[model samples]
Target: MAPEARIKILLKNGATALCAGLVALSSFSLGAEAARRHYRGHHHHIPQVPAAPPRALPYPQLPLPFEISGAQYLPLAWTDVKGWSDDNHLAAYKTFRASCKSINGQTGASEPKALGGSLSEPCRVAKTLELSDDAKAKTFFEDNFAPLRISRLGEPDGFVTGYYEPVLEGSRTQTDVFNVPVYRRPSNLFVRGYKQDSVSLPNKGPVYRKIGRRKLVPYYDRGEIEDGKIAGRGLEIAWLKDPTDLLFAQIQGSARIKFDDGGVVRLNYDAYNGYPYTAVGRVLIERGIVPKEEMSMQRIREWMAQNPDGAKELRRQNRSYIFFREVNLSDKDEAVGAQGIPLTAGRSIAVDKALHVYGTPFFIEGELPIDSERSKTPFHRLMIAQDTGSAIIGPARADLYFGAGQEAGRVSGRLRHPMHFVMLVPKGLDPSVRAAKLPVPDPRPSEKIAKLFPQTDPAKAGTPAAAAAPGKNETVATAGPVPLPVPRPAIEPAREPRRPVKNRSHRQQ
Candidate 1:
């Protein structure tokens, strides 16, 4: 009787406890739902779902200024090049032959690695061959080499501008009419190449010029020079009537100065203060001083004349400054380029020397200004790279020489258009083939990732994560990397030893 009663009592107590627990759990669930609904009603802006973490992207590759300047070459057939046959190759040959002298003179390990030894044989052939006409000269080039289109990485077309030797009327001494003074290179200025953390200025690479030896400081800018910073140092080369003419002469880097008498003096670029060149035309456009469509040298000059008050300040906005040395005005002297060779009027071109060889030939086909107003003129000529300029930065970029004098200045100023440039590479030296020989950087981003985060264990980092499947061989073309064109030193013509000038202000006309 006692066993049956105890079992029944235990079953009843367990049922009651289970029902109470279930009721408590239901009440808690209901309260939580009500609280969540109340919070949502009160806070209307907050999102209900939590945001996911952002995925990490691969670290980008950043190259130094030098690494990017590598010349990227793409090969093309001779027939593929436009207007190849019709060009006056005799003119190009004459210029090329002149360049050969410079090429032949360079010996030992100092030769340009880009051209290798290919230029030697072609240069020998150029010296002896006297082509009677353009037809024979064209045949010589066709037999010697193939054409390869050159460009910087990621960019397609190269820009070609025009530069000319400007002629100006001036006097040897400062008078009321001729007061502006041109300075010579300062003796104290020193250039320091690339530094990891620049000692003097921000991001100061290899091209920064400093002042003084005891206490090195940044060199004087254009404004300082105009303000008479180096005025008393006996640096005056010549004095001109118009300060604008002086500025233009500085920009051009060379000028023929006609004295009041029959005599003339040729001034060539010597050195520069380290500040980078900022285009004055760009400043005018930005300040709304002149409309972009009407922006030309003549137009800019007119605007400056009209705005007399702001002219000096406008010119000062460009920080770059150029110094000059006296060059002989002989028939053979002509206007020499940066390569120290006599520049042929129509045949010589100034290219990015950092990315190209001195004697390299490029066939440029673009519309130029042949007429007075400079509307449009067909230009398809083979240009020899005999010169270089600071602004000429890219692989395909070039500055075409348009001879000397005022008319040449007018035509040259009008040429600021894009052109198709094809480089005449020596025969058998294909750029693609040459590029294949060079080393390629690791393409796998993960390999770089390990390098970026060296603290992580190699075992934990896993095998080099690739962009493709495992064991797949991927090849990257190292022909040329994209380069940021850092400006070079001022273009200075090699001149004869400096001689004492006869100081005569009263002897002039």
Candidate 2:
């Protein structure tokens, strides 16, 4: 037979086998249900049988949220979102289209694990439609997806912070004014528990440095690096004005370097040391140096300026250090995010990548201190998940990206508040279906097991005789099954007796 004919035959056989297996699975489920019914009919006198739970709906209904994988999702109508009708959907749609460039590149088998290939159909439809008006763009999302109120299992609302691109004055070489160096990723750095030259490193894990051939050790921390460790290694990317500029840039993950010769250098996060990140602002609040209500990035900067020695000590409290790599971007362009796309100011957000996909749309509604530190204004808008950060963890935590410059930095630094998170999930991946598929817990123990473990006699239950403690010479009767002993209340231990002190002063005199 020809090779093409053999290949076709193999494909046909595989399809047939898949169909057969599905049919068998359906039959097995039906048989199990029938057996359950027959048992219930014959054993109607079994008092230990539990009542049936309410059946799950085929589609999500109102008022009851479904839970999956430690997150709760409450399906809602589009009108339920607070200011959905008034927001500019066109801007969000444009950002979504940009993210689709990355999403569409993925094959179905390699699609994001959180989305489970459900976004493929939505991306295809979005590409085919050329929407011009905000109304049409809004309709497109409404037609293709369902909005779900998402939160962590125990949290009441999602948290939102803001980040911005820090533009700082710097120099290419170490000068008198710009002496603090920004280092690039070291050649010896590697992911922990992996070979030195691993082609693919996992998204989440500790990183380490390799010495010689086989010995692996932790990378240099912030203090060691600040003390001039690993210097003269040809890893300097640029030199900033002071340590404060470099620290803030590291916290924000990216920065633009402005030089005196009318030149610009863009740097993006490349790697980090294995140590965990400790926020210095939180440390200040814990030590009562800064009040929690008045804490902000600007405040930290001002404090650092006034107390340089204390600032150095504060910086060393956070041991994690960041490395950067130069990117080729014009001054007019925005910074590229972890999603490999230019982030749209006010429209892009960094989410917990482990719990959410990059291209997912979220409708946020809240009041924020946008105008002043104490003033609150309504903030309702749609945002796209285009980035991820080390601090952005949990199902409901996010970081909103603001644009560049000092004003943007000021606004972003003051943005930290709780907000409502409504995720627009594709209809193909139904939350109702996922909830229904969860295995029902086993019913109460059967009558035979209950009989084997009989309950205490009600007549003797909680009586004085049953509750009384036995004396040392008492002989307790064990005529019938022994009842469980009643627990005694906890008693405080006896205190030590006071002793008289000697008159050491009189003896010295």
Candidate 3:
């Protein structure tokens, strides 16, 4: 009697407890965070501030009262790009298909011309992007845009009319991280490789007198300086997974000194002097700077030391140092511990001005992959709308900031690719923006040289020679006499003129 009755009693008690628990759980917040998370990206994009420079410039270390008098910041003068200006990125097409369903109001498909000739994320047929209702915009953004521009950077058509502010996660002396949900996906790659990998600042004290400037200090020229030894003027590009220690080593010209006991160690001096918001790391593996099938950090040290002749600074001409601020632990004097950037040093992303205006959202499509090992792609990037770098003087060019520290260094250094970009300009804004003013066309070389050379100077130039026969290229010799329009016979002149010898013969006969 007790066993059968016990089972029935237990069942009754279990049912009552379950009912009580359900009553408690239902009273809590109703998907409050989950419901509103999608709207986080609306108010994040900030237009260029009054304090922001016209062009994002790299910060370099110079001596006290750094007399950079002759230094001139180059302006954006880009003009042409071969492809991707219209519909180059593959992603733009996909974005339109995904976003158009909701944005079209009535759904079918739009003609390609309506898409503004691009394939950016949330690429509603450029014709169909009219935001008549909230539902369409939300749906169009959700499918294509959320992945690229919505939560990343650049104010996609209507994010800011909603409420949100970027949340910074560090103090002034620390590396501040501003996190946003909406960001752009890169499409076109307009990387300008430095003609030479690096250059040094020209110390002009000695040469100043020659140029009629007496009060000169150390200076660099974007064009010309008399001194040949001063090095380069701007940022040098290198790929690295971790650039912290490497940066320190570069400035110090020595390897990072780790203790034999495998504990903490430090260097004595401002190894980071002149470099701001930048961190150093021992990046020897990822960049292929030191090639190896399987090399450890220790082996990397050995390789650098053994090959002391190896690229010590690994510097190049025409490339400059990209500077940012870093937060260092107070254990050492001015030793940067974590690199945080308030302002990045290059204008890697920009609007076509003629197409997508500044502050417009875009998605870039290309093959340069992001490393999930350190950071992943779907970069969730932002376009500050800053202008070109000195290296990016060409109109169709973009100076991609590899970012600060080692991880960014690696991604940036390895970032050699051809890409196409697609973006949304502020709707109704004219795509005919004459943003980057005009320049006279480059002169034809033959005409330019004709005026300058006047049939002299050996007809020499930097141009390559012609194919002499097939596969052979010895420069054509132009030393022979100019060919004549008509042939001239090589006959000797007659010595005597017609004479009166016949008159003398008549008298003698």
Tell me, by lDDT, which candidate is best. Answer: 2
Best by TM-score: 2
Give TM per candidate. Answer: 0.68, 0.72, 0.26
Please write out the lDDT profile of model 1 over residues 318-341, one tens digit for every residue.
777877878776467589777777
What is the Cα-based lDDT of residue 262 in candidate 1? 80
Off by over 4 Å in 1: 1-71, 111-113, 116-118, 193-214, 372-374, 433-509
Count of steric clashes across candidates, in order: 3, 0, 55
* Residue-by-residue lDDT tens digits, candidate 3, 1-509: 79989999999999999998887676454455544554554645445567755673343332222111222111111122222233323233332333333344433553223123223323344455545554454344333332211111222221110000111122111122311111011111011231111222111112111123234332232112213222232211111222333333332211123222443222211111111221111234446655443433334445655654443443222122222212222322222211111222222242222222122334444333456323434432222322222122222223344334445434444433334433333222223232223233567788975565444233544335432333456444444334337767789988887766554455555
- Residue 181 error, candidate 1, Å: 1.3
lDDT of 3: 0.31
Candidate 3 residue runs with Cα over 4 Å from true position: 1-306, 313-361, 372-389, 399-410, 427-429, 432-509
Please give the ranking of all candidate structures by lDDT, highest first, separated by commas: 2, 1, 3
Q: What lDDT tens digits, residue by residue, belong to model 2 across residues 1-509?
A: 99999999999999999999999999999999999889989976557878798897654444322333567668788888999998999999999998998989975375435566677788899999888899999998898888899888888799999899999999999989999999987789888666554532333457778888879788888999999987999999999988999999988888999999999998877677877778899999999999999999999999999999999999999998888888878444999887878989999999877677889899999998888888898999999999876667778888889988898899889987999999888887757656566556565577755566655566896799776767877875534455669899799999899898876765555
